[model samples]
Target: MALWKHLVQAASAITLAAAFTSVASAQETVNIGYTGPLSGGAALYGKNTLVGLEMAAKEINEAGGFEVGGKKYKFNIVALDDKYSPSEAAVNAKRLKSQNNTPMVFTPHSGGAFAIQAFNEQDNFILGAYTSVPNMTERGNKLTLRIPPSFAGYVQPFINVEMKAFGKKLAMAGGDHDYAKAWAQLFGPAWKQAGGEIVAENPMSYNKDTDFYSGVSRVLAANPDVLFVGGASEPTALVAKQARELGFKGGFVVMDQAKLDEMAAVVGGMDMLEGSVGVLPLIYDKRPGTEAFIAKFKKLYDRNPGTEASYHYSTLNAVSEAMKLAGTVSDPKAIHAKLSEAYGKLPPERNPARITSVDDRGGTNANIVVGMVKNGKVETIEAASLGQ
Candidate 1:
């Protein structure tokens, strides 16, 4: 009888331990990964994106976190610095998937975003981003979602205005970066489609070299009526300054990467930006919903929100809403499906005017606004113009 009692006690202890372990495992926290350039030329972009994500996480946690299948799971962010390198992004993606068990990743830059997109496909992880690459969502990659308007969508309005103002004879001067190259590839076809002629195309390497006199001279020799300056703030500004200095009085169409302040500062104030058109929607414009976001972002960061920051914030909101709607964080596939549905079903108060719907491939049907630099700031020249 003593031996039987001892055996029963051991079995009871094992059962209790197993039950406790199961409960603990079921209450695991939900982890979300954010990958971007935190220590390179694009560090500002990554930093701003992180701020947005942090804000979203704080808001969600304040609301008692996300409820999933009758259980409450707190949202946690695991940020990995890829330094804007494709290889590093790939490695970071794998780590987030395997070790962190992250079902979704938010990427900011184009190269890193595309790298993660490729990895997500192979690993069956859901990848979302504010990066504006149309091809990222073109093929119906169910696991991929884009938060911002694609480069193609954004560029169309600028192209339309430029073609109408300056008769064809286009010259492309864009950075050699992935995003810029992608823009260049689309520019030729897009310009041709608008009945414009491409006189010459020149790609310049930026971030390392600042002297764009040579590149500007080359584009000048083409004698095009207008030049397309594609790349981030610094390079675009340098190109514009150098082109103007070289006595090229032609019109300039800056890409989305060229922020108004940076362009004006680089090219000797708003005079250079005057009459120049760009693709990025102006953030500080007097839009109905944007004012609240701008005010809140300024209060938190103590600075005006740029395109990178605003887009990142919007992406985070989209993700959080999807999680809430799905009511579970276990299956990434289900979460992705929920995201698509939530994106469309979001109430007007939760939805931004820029974004309308998500297609089957997770491409956002957002309308891109056209703006021109006037008086040292970006002015919305076209309202609700879907350049398509």
Candidate 2:
């Protein structure tokens, strides 16, 4: 009888150990790879984007993980800094796919998005682009998606106002990347049609550019009524600051890639960014959806979420919900299709209002409200005022 008791106790211990192991294995982790500029001039853009991505992951994991394949999988990100370089992004994408086995990878710019797109189809992964370039979805890559309204839409309204209020002479300066090149090229025809003359076009490598004094001086000498401050918030702010110091104060036509509020802090005065207009800030949008996101984001990060990161947040939430609907986290193709189907059907609990708009190419056709810096903040302008 004593020997029988010993055997039964050993069997009970084995059962308990097996139960613990089963529970631990049930909560599997799903990692998504993200590539962007985390330590360069565009670090703020990349970091803010990552902040939203991570916040989404944390919220999903906190809600007992995303259900897939009859098991619960926690979402996480294996992010790498690509410095907004296509070459680095390609290499990073390859590594993330082969080594990390991530179903999706996030890139914040057109260059990186294109690099990943060149081969992501073959590698079988989704390219989540937090980009402002229209070409991102123009090619019809089934796996690629644009995050926000393209830089393509920002020019018509901007030039409409600048040509009338500022003057007819305009000069453009930006990096030679795909998005910057697209911005400069797309704005020219609009400017010309609106009775504005393109006085000069100066393109530099943001990766190599340390000082804009030389470019700003030369461009200012051309007697431009508006200097197009291009690229992300940091470089755009830098251009605004340098231009102000160089005494070019007619007007600053900021690009949509950067956040105006962030740039306002850098340039440090309404006098500097006065008459400057770009994308509308979420704080200014005041939509119930946007306001709620702002409140939730502020509660966690103690600050307002910017445009780029907010797109990232929407993408993450949408992707996870799609995965749950797809019922297979490993299949990118299924998840991508399900993403299109589940776009607006996301549960209200999972930031339902974020499904604001989705174009045919899976890109978000978010609003393109250009506002000038009034009273040290971005004040929205009526599109009708610009004849847009």
Candidate 3:
């Protein structure tokens, strides 16, 4: 009886080991690379977006690793902290490509996106960029999958609204980075077209311009109707806070980088955000499945997902669906084609709340919906997209 008992225990161990090996064998893993500011001043934006991407991966794995054309794949996200530096983004991209053979990479920063885009096609990996710079897809890079609407999309709703409702004369102040320059270019012309004038343009270095009070105070001196404050989430909030403390009562532009929740936390609620206009995140956009996504995201990350997370989630969803259709995750051309195809299939009813279209250039066209902050919450106002 003792020998029989020992044999049974041995058999059980063997069976468990076989099961584990089989589970591993059944699912094939594909590592997706992400390089962004996982630490430093922009950690909130980068980490939250990483959470959204991982959340998508989790859901896909839970649903039994999608099978396409008899090929099964389990996706894993590989992220590295770039400290929000473009050179670091390139270095990490090389590491991810060499070490992990990542089929695709997501970089939320425009400067980093540019770095990735420069060689991604030659490297034969798809570039999943969250930057809203209008010219990203215009470069005609097939591997470039720009997931968010261009800054041009924010013009009609954010700038135009602030122009008419708040005041006609507007002032712009932000980091003199390429992304901010693109935004200023787009918004400046849009406001000009709307019969408004840009009173002052204040450009400062992102890291050096920590004391926004000094610069913003000068911009406020212009006494414009609205101030388009640009930068990462924390800096934008700081600028807004400084503007408020300086007794400047007017509208603000959140520059697509700042999350309302984080901004509220920093500036003490939505009282300072009244008449502010900017990207409406999932928590406020209420796009189809937005609330569901928000609930799931909150449950996983224990915080409200802002635009960074929501758009990353949407793009990650698009990428997954594209891979499933393309039947191969490593083929750049196939994945690129399927991305646009998947976008066509995903609608509001199909859980496509923010995205409206994906053009051939791989540029996404999401409808313009600006959020107005009221008492620490957001109120959304839909507006037409660029050229609409």
Top lDDT hit: 3
The TM-score measured for candidate 3 stands at: 0.86
TM-scores for every candidate against the unseen true structure: 0.86, 0.83, 0.86
Q: Can you tell me which runs of candidate 3 are displaced by over 4 Å? A: 1-27, 347-353, 374-377, 385-388
What tens digits encode model 2's per-residue C-alpha lDDT throughout 1-388? 9999999999999999999988776447777999989997778778988987898898888989877777888887999999979899999999999988999998887778888888998999999887767778888788876777667767888887776678999988777766677788788777887788889888766656768888888888898999886776777888888888888767777777667777777767556788787777767766566677788888998987786666777778888878888888889988887775565765444442354556768676544557877656678775546666
Clashes (N, CA, C under 3 Å) per candidate: 1, 0, 0
lDDT of 3 at 190: 82
Using lDDT as the yardstick, the better of models 2 and 3 is 3
Better of 2 and 3 by TM-score: 3
Could you arrange the candidates by lDDT from highest to lowest? Answer: 3, 2, 1
Give candidate 3's error at residue 68 in angstroms. Answer: 1.0
Q: Which tens-of-lDDT digit does each residue in 1-388 have in candidate 3?
A: 9999999999999999999988767457888999999889778778867877888788878888777778677889999999999999999998999899888989988889988878888888988888778888889888888888777767777766676568788888877877777787787888888888889889766645667877887888889889988776667888888888899888887787666666777777888888787777567656557777877877876877766777777777777788888888778789888887776666453343467668888888766677877655688777764233
The local distance difference test score of each candidate is 0.74, 0.78, 0.79
Q: Ten consecutive residues with minimal summed lDDT in candidate 2?
A: 347-356
Q: Could you list the CA RMSD of all candidates, in the order they appear?
A: 4.7, 3.5, 4.2
